[model samples]
Target: MKLLCWNIRGFGFTGRRRQLIEYLRQEEIDIVGLQETIHQDFSMHELQGLSRHQFAWQWLPSTGQSGGIFLGVREDVFSVEDMDRGEFFLSMSVTDRRVHFSWEVIFVYGPADHARSAGFLAEPKNKVERCTTPVVVAGDFNLISWASDKSSPNVDRVRMRLFNDCIADLALRHEGLGANLGADLRARKGALLDQIKVLDDLDDGQGLCPDGWLRRYALESSLMDIYKSEELFWQRRGGQNWLLKGDANTAYFQAIANGRRRKCAIPFLWDGDVLLESLEDISTHIYSFYKELFSAEPRGGVSLCADFWPLADQVSDAENADLTLPVFPEERMTAPWLRNSVKRLVRYFQLGASAATPLLQCSDRAGRPP
Candidate 1:
């Protein structure tokens, strides 16, 4: 069975609506989940227009202009058993007649507001825990799985934490395009359409020569490498000790690395005010406050000891001398065990250093301190 998910942003524009209908008809998609329809109500005419291929749909309308969720299923292919709709999601239980297989699908449109989004994300986990059927949760989460999911240097640590925690706690498997391409194409649906066309053509074996195929393969391989490298870079920046190793380039690991970065961030500071947002300002404020705090003189205090005494009463000169003697000989440091331990530590350090050297160089090239 084929499933297509897209955040169409809105269906208000006639051109976009036509494009969507055309795409749906051309692809002959069996199931689709759409987000940000931006319409509070769908008229009969609108429903007829959207259900071009006899697909039935359920929608959770937007609150004013902000949020909407939609799910559509081809009537000839599957039968919908139950549906539940909310402000942020539209879920349905469906069975495909072709295979007699049934599953639950949760189509989500997470709110732009972080708090609401957190609650919306958690609902699926709860649903999965309670339901016996296999569930496929899909939508525009408005949350990235890694720090490198976007090109921005700064990341929303709190929101990312909540997002990643939800995914991990539920053990959900995330499958999609590479992070770089996803971020790049996020705002350009036209480019995304072109990519889809290319893939379709390639699947039909109707486009590109052996050389072109080789180039495409090389390009994909390079993109995958870069994606994995970026993930590793962020992992290292977040002070993670574990290596990604092998083909661990899935969204689960990316979410994990993003969560680690969030935790590693300085969320807030205890500067008189409970939380300070500016890192540099907070650093300066904390440094000055602590410096003065440590430098301040103490007030009057009572002394616990009455007087001082010599150590002669506690030990003889020979005993004192013996106690002061060094515990090991100078040559003892050269023992095989000690030498081996030190060598092992050095080797480990070198391995880690080598692994991190590329990240350091990249940071330097970007004119950022490592």
Candidate 2:
């Protein structure tokens, strides 16, 4: 079961989308966990109609009402169970028929400016410390990992200690089987806020390879007819990936980190080579890790200041927020606000949330004509 966890950044692109289709077509990945989906309604269409993969998806909302996560699994191999906690998180269970074993998968959108961020690393470390099951955790953690995985030529001082402590604290079982493309992965070096850990499994015996090419060795199921896909690529953002596309180059990525630039509606990864998978766009890596056993949770609706939120119409300037609004889909603040609202409301219905949470009162972060 090959799973791809990624922070796709955004789903707007044409060229980058093509490149993504090309890769996934070759990768045929299974579970994809995402975060910062930045969409109002977390629709299942991205997965349900994704190429030939039959799947289910769920979107979780954040306390500030601006972001969340979604997960997708190939329908043929797994079964899905929606865990609707639209208020703070999104989750689902995927089961394989051969082994009735099932796991819960959670998509998280970390609070950028919250007190919880200060105290929760150890909390999860302690929480997962006793865990003994398949758990795949991936996302743009915002926290920095030692800059390299086991396959790295050498571990950095800061990165090494952080990972070691996590292992000791989480009592995590093992790193997933890998080509250990650590050094190869950061060939250009300079990566922040992304990592994947698998419990109950150690390196699949293959040590690190010189390049991250080990992905080539994995079995791929996503390959739908290449010819047909090339013809159907409806990708709109052609120059976003910067990696594969000429315009969205790494220079811009560096600028963002160096503080040489400010946030743009531009996404981190936007290219045809990188399909703007809403779930994958937000979450990345080890998606199947917690499908069944590991468990840690959000504080709940009690922590949210629901009153601070603007009415859908008032949302246009809502703290100045809005979702799926054409005005600024590229802007992080606006899109996430509306995306999660829609996701929260939709999920509220899907999970059979109390009828009191009336969807009618809800407005797309940017209030529109009723």
lDDT top scorer: 1
Q: After superposition, which runs of candidate 2 have C-alpha atoms over 4 Å from their true positions? A: 14-24, 44-47, 61-67, 81-90, 107-109, 112-116, 119-133, 147-167, 173-370
Per-residue C-alpha lDDT of model 2 across residues 193-309, encoded as one tens digit per residue: 111122112244454453322332221112222223333332322233444645344775566556644543333444447555464653442244444346666566643244543
> Which portions of model 1 miss their true places by more than 4 Å?
178-370
Highest-scoring model, TM-score: 1
Give per-model TM-scores: 0.47, 0.37
Q: After superposition, how far is residue 47 of candidate 1 from its true place, in Å?
A: 1.7
TM-score of candidate 1 versus the correct structure, residues matched by position: 0.47
Mind giving the per-residue lDDT tens digits that candidate 1 earns over 1-370? Answer: 5687888888787887888787777888788888898878778788777655777788887888777777888879888888877656788888765334578888887777765776777676777777677788888888887898979978888888888888878866665553344343332334334544575588688777776555455445545555675676566644532443423777767787798999888857776656687888778887988899899687567532322223332334453333233334443546764665465445435445434233222222332212
**Candidate 1 clashing pairs, residues 3+ apart or interchain:** none
